[model samples]
Target chain A: GQQVMQIPQYQHVQEGEDFTTYCNSSTTLSNIQWYKQRPGGHPVFLIQLVKSGEVKKQKRLTFQFGEAKKNSSLHITATQTTDVGTYFCAGPVGAGSYQLTFGKGTKLSVIP
Target chain B: SAVISQKPSRDICQRGTSLTIQCQVDSQVTMMFWYRQQPGQSLTLIATANQGSEATYESGFVIDKFPISRPNLTFSTLTVSNMSPEDSSIYLCSVELAGRYEQYFGPGTRLTVT
Candidate 1:
């Protein structure tokens, strides 16, 4: 079985501050995907990282995958009130497996 | 990207009652998955529903407790049988589009078992 662990289960930051959440896996993953869930909404797909040591950016958010493909991180620069949500990192059940095993997720709260 | 819709956006059920949630997708998809999210917790994979066959449940889930049906490519249902107070959670349906790494989720059905 594959397990994914996320750090900083909860985070509170002032508006305009930065935030980062890290995810680690017990085994190497073929790819990792990030998702965001609002206060009372379903989880939404954010981004996916496939190549090892890959870095992708969307607006103010940046995603990075470890060289070993066993870990990943999401960093948000100058967070805003709209960034309040739970961020989750998910990895495939196995190599070439479409099923995903999700981490516990990091809940972010921004104070304006 | 695909458009997904779930029936009965939220429901309150008594213990020992069973509730069936329906998931419908606008476009055809190869794989559909069900997930449960407990209060203040993350998402957990419950099962994978493929068209024209039995669902593949996770380690703790079983067919008797969480029976699932995949009648066609764009439709599926999950029935939570003999549910208890602990079963109160949000059930989400997701679909994996062809050649896409990300799975898109439908608006979850919030279930509260009293």
Candidate 2:
């Protein structure tokens, strides 16, 4: 069995402040994916990191994968109210497996 | 990207009742998964519903309680049998398109058992 752990179960920040969530896995992953779930909406795919030590950015948000592919991080610069949601990091249950093992997720609240 | 639709967006059921949630994808897909998310909790993989064969359930989840049927490649149903208060949660279905690793989740069925 595989497990994914995320840090900072809940976080509150000023509108202009920054936020970061860390994710670690009990086993190495072939690829890691990030998802965002709003207050009442379903989980939406945000990004996916495949290469080790890869860094991808989407506007104010940045995603990085560890060199060992066992950990990852998501950083949001100058967070806004719309950035309030739960961010989950997931990885395949096993190599070549489509089933994903999701981390507990980090719930971010950006105060206006 | 696939367009996914789920039936009965939200429902309130009594104890010992069963609710069947339907998941339909616009296009044919090979992999479909059911997940349960409690209030302020993470998504838990319930089972993988692949067309043609029996579903593979995760640990602590049994078929008798959460039976699934993948009658076709684009449609599936999950029945929550003899549910109780603890079964109150949001049930979501996700599909993995061919050659795409990312999964697209449905709006989810919010269930509340009293």
Candidate 3:
């Protein structure tokens, strides 16, 4: 079984401030994915990191995959009110399972 | 990402009752999954809703308690049998689209068992 844990369970920051959440896994992963769940909404796919030490970006958000495939990270720059939500990182295990292990999440609240 | 819709967005059921949540996808998919999230908690895997076959349950979930039906590629249903207070949570259904390698989730059914 694989497990993912995210740091800063809860965080409050002023608008325009930067934030970072770290995810560590209990077992090696073949690929990792990130999701965002808005208040009272279902989870939405954000990005997927498959290679070792991979990095990708979408506007203000930056994602990094660890070389060891045991960890990942999400960083937001100049956060806006729209960025307030829970971010979950999921790791897909080996072949055939297609099961994803998700982190508890990092809850971010942007204070204007 | 595929579009997904879930039925009975929210409900309040008495103890010992049951709820059946339905999920419909706009496009045909290969993999459909079910998950549960308690109040302010992370998502937990329930089972992988297999089309034309019985679902595969997780460590804590079982078929008798949480029976799932996936008759086709784009439709599925999860029935929470003999509900209890502890069963109150948000149940979600997701689909992993073919060739995309991305999973999209349904809005989810919020169940409250009293």
Better of 2 and 3 by lDDT: 2
Interface RMSD of each: 0.7, 0.5, 0.9
- Worst 10 contiguous positions by lDDT, candidate 1 chain A: A93-102
lDDT of 1 by residue, B54-77 (tens): 899999999999999999999999
Residues B11-70, candidate 2: write the lDDT tens digits. 999999999999999999999999999989999999999999999999989999999999
lDDT of 3 by residue, B1-114 (tens): 788999989999999988899999998887899999997889998999878778889899989999999999999999999999999999999998775556899999999999
Off-target runs (Cα >4 Å) in candidate 2 are none
RMSD of each: 0.8, 0.8, 1.1
Candidate 2, residue B100: how far the Cα is off, in Å: 2.0
In model 1, the runs with Cα more than 4 Å from the true position are none
Error of 2 at B41 (Å): 0.1
lDDT of the candidates, in the order given: 0.96, 0.96, 0.90
Report the number of the highest-DockQ candidate: 2
**Clashing pairs in model 3, backbone N/Cα/C closer than 3 A:** none
Better of 1 and 3 by lDDT: 1
Question: What tens-digit string does per-residue lDDT give for candidate 2 at A1-112?
Answer: 8999999899999999999999999999999999999999999999999999999999999999999999999999999999999999999999988999999999999889
